[model samples]
Target: MAEALDQARAGRDAAGTALVAETRAVVAAAGAMSARFRSGGRLLAFGRNGGAADAAHVAVEFTHPVIVGKRALPALSLGEDPSTLPILGRPRDIVLGIRPAPDDLAVAREHGMLTVALTMGRRRPEADHVLPALSEDPLIAREIHVTMYHLLWELVHLFLEGETEA
Candidate 1:
């Protein structure tokens, strides 16, 4: 039990370090994302890794605003499949594709949408903003992505609400 706990702690520590490495990129991406939202663009998230949880998580967080007083933004999950995007996506919208398959990635680009990705490795060829997974362990990947997305949901407000760092 102690061994497992230690492993988990190490993984989390690594994930935090990885996130720190990506901090500047994340800030830039969030700035661009904030601009999109300001221009009446909505966020459309999709996952093709056999489940819709990632997309659902992103959509819900953006649409509902987990923090109090943050305005609810428009967002939707395109489900577990990728084909729906070509039909549903608009040029002004941003596509947050989670572990997208090649086909979905292609379709997303064809739609001319601003693309961001949360993935397990290097940025997929399709994602303009790619956040690589911090660890190879599946559990670590999940933990990192959840924390990353949640941080995104919270920090994005700073850009949108005109808050400056103290």
Candidate 2:
């Protein structure tokens, strides 16, 4: 029990550190995402293996908000095959990649879409914004990614509502 508790505490500490390190980038990305959505843009998320699940999760969160009264936004998960991105993506769309292929991000950038990458390793993919998980454990890294995306969703809504009032 002590071992489990220690591991959990370590994971929490790592998550907090990673989030703090990337706070500025996350805020900037959320602002950009809000702008894109305000301009009638959709969010296209893609990943492979475990990342595919994350992509779908992100899409559902935006398209089907669990919180009542919150606006639903357009979002789609491309799953493992990102080849369709070129066909489905639009200039105003936001592309979210979780450990995605570099070429896919490049294509999204070329098409004038906003690109955000969630990575967990030494190699960082090119994107408008990159959030890298600090933990070496895959499970912990995934937790960090999940938290980061949730933050993005929440902040995007905050920015969107704020802009509406302004």
Candidate 3:
């Protein structure tokens, strides 16, 4: 039990340190994407089997504000609705392809939506920004998803707090 606890703490520490360094860069990138979306841009998120949850979580974080002190940002998850996807097949709208394609990423970039891809399979689209995650082990993948989102939420909260104060 003691060993397990220690290992967990170590993991948390590592994640935290890496996040502290990475958060500013991510926030800047996300903010740029958000700006484009504000000017009639949309968000397109795609993932394979494991990517589905990561895509969904990101969508939720942007669509609905989770941080207690931050405002909600506009975002969409293409994978969540099979029915709607059929109607909105265009790249301008959020579309989740079954597989990755170079064209897909290009379209997403062209349309001004930040492309977020989650995959454990052959690298496809080559998104403008790729957030690599565990492709194997379902449990580990879920943990990664949770940890990544927590970091994102914290960064967003910080940004929002500064904005409101200003």
Candidate 4:
């Protein structure tokens, strides 16, 4: 029982520290994303299997903000549809790859879309922004991702309103 608590504490501490270190970058990314949104760009988030699930969560949260008085932003999930982005993507739009499959970032880059990749130490040069999960354990990675996306949602809104450090 104590071991579980220790592990949880360690995971949380590591995630918190990593996120703090990346706070400036996160805000910067959010600022750019907000600019795109203000210019009529939509956010396209996609992933496969577990990534797909995170994409769904991000889509709904961004499209239907739970916070009172927050504006609902335009966002959609690509799911498993390979044709979705090619059909609807614009240069001003943004793409987020949650544990994306091979070629995902390449495709988004080719379309000239702003690409944000949530990955675990995998260098993604095709992406404009790369946020690391910072954990090797799958469970820890999942928890960190949940926190990261939630922060992304909140920070995006804050950035849009000029209430953040962006």
TM-score of each: 0.87, 0.90, 0.56, 0.86
What is the clash tally of candidate 2? Answer: 0
Error of 3 at 64 (Å): 2.9
Candidate 1 least-lDDT 10 residues: 119-128
Candidate that scores best on TM-score:
2
Best by lDDT: 2
Cα-based lDDT for every prediction: 0.77, 0.87, 0.50, 0.79
Q: Tens digit of lDDT per residue, candidate 4, span 58-125?
A: 99999998889999999999875535777789999999888766577777678888888777544344
What stretches of model 4 exceed 4 Å from their correct place? 1-8, 80-83, 121-125, 163-165
lDDT of candidate 1 over 55-156, digit per residue (tens): 898999999875689999999998887677778888888888777665566766677777877776554556778876767676667666777777777777
Better of 2 and 3 by lDDT: 2
Task: Report the lDDT tens digits of candidate 3 across residue range 20-62.
Answer: 5545555654444444444454445555554566667777876
Tell me which of candidates 1 and 2 scores higher on TM-score.
Answer: 2
Question: Per the 3 Å backbone cut-off, how many clashing residue pairs does candidate 1 have?
Answer: 0
Report how far off residue 68 is in candidate 2 (Å).
1.8
Give the RMSD in angstroms, all C-alphas superposed, for model 4. Answer: 2.4
Runs of candidate 2 with Cα error greater than 4 angstroms are 1-12, 164-166
Tell me the spans in candidate 3 whose CA falls farther than 4 Å from its real position. Answer: 1-25, 37-40, 80-104, 119-125, 134-138, 160-166
Report how far off residue 143 is in candidate 3 (Å).
2.2
